[model samples]
Target: MSVRTATESDLEAWVALRLLLWPDTSPDTHRAEAAAVLAAPEATAFLEKAEDGSMRAFAEAALRHDHVNGCETSPVAFLEGIFVRAEDRGRGHGARLLAAVRDWARGRGCAELASDAHLSNVGSRAFHAALGFDETEHVVFFRMPL
Candidate 1:
């Protein structure tokens, strides 16, 4: 029941948790993307290790200077993803991981923390709201074959 900064050696377990978080993603793409993030200095990942020495939850944050949902030119701390295993919920691990990201973002000069969850994921929506996030708008997107 401890939270700590993620290390390169933790990549496999971290990626495994990510696969569980986004089950629709293929393993190959996950591997490549995880590797890239783990190698980036601007990105930070945090993991909650269980008493048994296994990763039970994790979160990732990155510095985003580009225009985001409602912001202008100022850089923002963008939460890439966050997940906690069903068996590990309600144990304060999620809060710890989030706190780490908040501190990291604050240290980087970010005035705000921004993140989004699928509209249908009630739990995520609730969690974000509990963390003081307000709904800005509903975003819909479309894609066309080129």
Candidate 2:
């Protein structure tokens, strides 16, 4: 499996995989968001393709100049999303995609990479830990509508 940076041509496939990861969001929204990320200089996405050229996994990241929850520096790389097809898990595709993201961040002068998973997502937590991420803190958000 070869991992590479995603380009405009990969939009449709990227949105498809994004839906699998965030099914609650609409496809139109995913398309718009994917397009924006593709056009943003501070953000990037990496994709892994199979021998047949089908997309097997994808990861999106961005350089966050603001404070990142657990990081101690400005301009940290934030992993916005990563998804591997259920059948493709455990094949190291995710790791390879992350490696690419790491390189991209380092190229942009980012010192650290930060990411978050939902509190109840045990598998996601384990995935982060397995990849050498240390748990920093847990946070709960509150919202009030006017």
Best by lDDT: 2
Per-prediction TM-score to the true structure, in the order listed:
0.93, 0.97
- The alpha-carbon lDDT assigned to residue 35 of candidate 2 equals 94
Collision pairs in model 1: none
User: Residue-wise lDDT of candidate 1 within 80-139, one digit each (tens)?
Assistant: 999999998877777888999999999999888888888998999998888777877779
How many pairs collide in each candidate, listed in order?
0, 0
Q: Write the per-residue lDDT of candidate 2 for residues 11-100, one digit (tens) a residue.
A: 999999999999999999999999999999999999998888889999999999988898999899999999999999998988898899
Model 1 ranges off by over 4 Å: none
Global CA lDDT computed for model 2:
0.93
lDDT of each: 0.87, 0.93
Candidate 2 clash pair list: none
The CA lDDT at 46 in model 1 is 89
Best by TM-score: 2
The candidate 2 region of ten consecutive residues with least summed lDDT is 124-133
lDDT of 1: 0.87
